[model samples]
Target: MKKFIMCFVGAMLVLSLAACTPTPVKQSESATEPMVEASTGGASDKVPDPNVEPMEIISVYSSNEDATGLNQAMDAVDELTAQSLVDKLIEYGVLEEGTEVLEFDTKDGIGTLDLSKVPSSGTSGELLMLTAIGNTFTENFELDKLKLLVDGKNYSSGHIEHGDNDYLEYNRDYKKL
Candidate 1:
């Protein structure tokens, strides 16, 4: 019957869409079990080994800056990692020593930063921290935007709330607070 045929076609279409959806990367329960996603593009997705390089220098952004608002520390990319950058920030007094990078991934020019925690600093401090993160990742990875997530969800703190689709842009002019 004509009705049966239409129903079959609609079912097929729904099945096709579901099939085309990309599988999400599963979150690991512990640091020992590292979560891995398949890379669709170049080597940028994989962080280089710290031991194997004619070290590449990367600009590690910091909240510490003078009038021009461009504050950065040059660091050798022994391992290109979100945590490494965070470590640099801590060294520069941007973030606390205990903070950890929960997850970091980049695809199609969008980088995601899932953090174990976001500092309870006030609005200005929060903005500066985000600026440091966004600029550091975008510049180093050649990404267009950076998404900040706390514990696998959109970043929400007493200071700021990012929407589901919200992202941070690379900004170089953030002044010291």
Candidate 2:
């Protein structure tokens, strides 16, 4: 009876060990092939692929929240990676909706942004806009300063004053009024 019990225990242990073992899966050669056909067309045909992963969303300062002057009002804008930061700010009502980026260029550590329209607002509003725009550009680009222009002319609002060609230091800090 002892011999039979010992043999039964040994068999049970072997079976348990076997049950816990993992099985290897064999993959076919076709499984490693490309899933989609490569495009052979020109550069214009290279539109954004829907199957590709989407870009990350980001937050920016909003003028509406700047009025309170207690906490920074950072508004989340979606699907704005393709759009310019200024456009996103405008869409968020930080600037006038009619404001358009005519041309933007960065060279020799200096960045220039030419706009077709400029928002007319109070000094505090202008300051908030400038801070938001300056921060956005400096944070993204490698630049020592930024020059903002509207229709090839200098930009001056109630409180802010700068020449059409003057380079303004990139400042991200904002003070509440």
Candidate 3:
């Protein structure tokens, strides 16, 4: 009688535990078919494309001292856009010809530019480069701040100093082209 009671209690406990546990949801194969069809598009309906191209306007700075004004253009923006903009500055004599952006990343609303490949110019030159970069990124990403890393170390723009991990806010008023 004791064995029977213990067995009954154990069974009840197991059943109660099982009842409290959530069951795995089983979806029918047909239910998933609609989602797949929607992604691929159906004969009658048009599905919105997810791979739409990104349109970005870049602010390109000229090297000429007299040309403080920026030139703007609608271009396909990417990580390399930072490098291209810097290269344009160098070509025009705004930045040193060898200056380049090695890598770029935007995470958690903070944009970082790796300038390991770029050599150090003077404070005035660095300030100009920084302004051009800040303006370009802010305009495109709507970001109010950015970080510059030179050779894996935090780079000070000389105009606005930022801590090692701090993001520098865009403070320059760039003239539109």
| Top of the candidates by lDDT | 1
Local distance difference test, each candidate: 0.81, 0.67, 0.63
Comparing 2 and 3 on TM-score, the stronger one: 2
Which is better, 1 or 2, measured by TM-score? 1
Backbone clashes in model 2, listed as residue pairs: none
| lDDT for each residue of candidate 2 in 27-138, tens digit (9 for 90 to 100) | 5677767466567798877788888765645545555453733123444444443145777777767667777788888888888888888777777667667766666665
Q: Pick the candidate with the highest TM-score.
A: 1
Which run of 10 residues does model 1 get worst, by summed lDDT? Answer: 63-72
Clashes of each: 1, 0, 2
Candidate 3's residue-wise lDDT over 59-175, tens digit each?
A: 554333445544444444454366766665566555566776787888777788777554456665565556666666665566757887776777755455667767656655555
Provide the TM-score for each candidate, comma-separated.
0.63, 0.57, 0.48
Global local distance difference test of model 1: 0.81
> Which residue pairs come into collision in candidate 1?
50-78
Off by over 4 Å in 1: 1-53, 65-70, 175-177
Window of ten residues with lowest summed lDDT in model 3:
61-70
Q: List the residue pairs that clash in candidate 3.
A: 63-93, 63-94
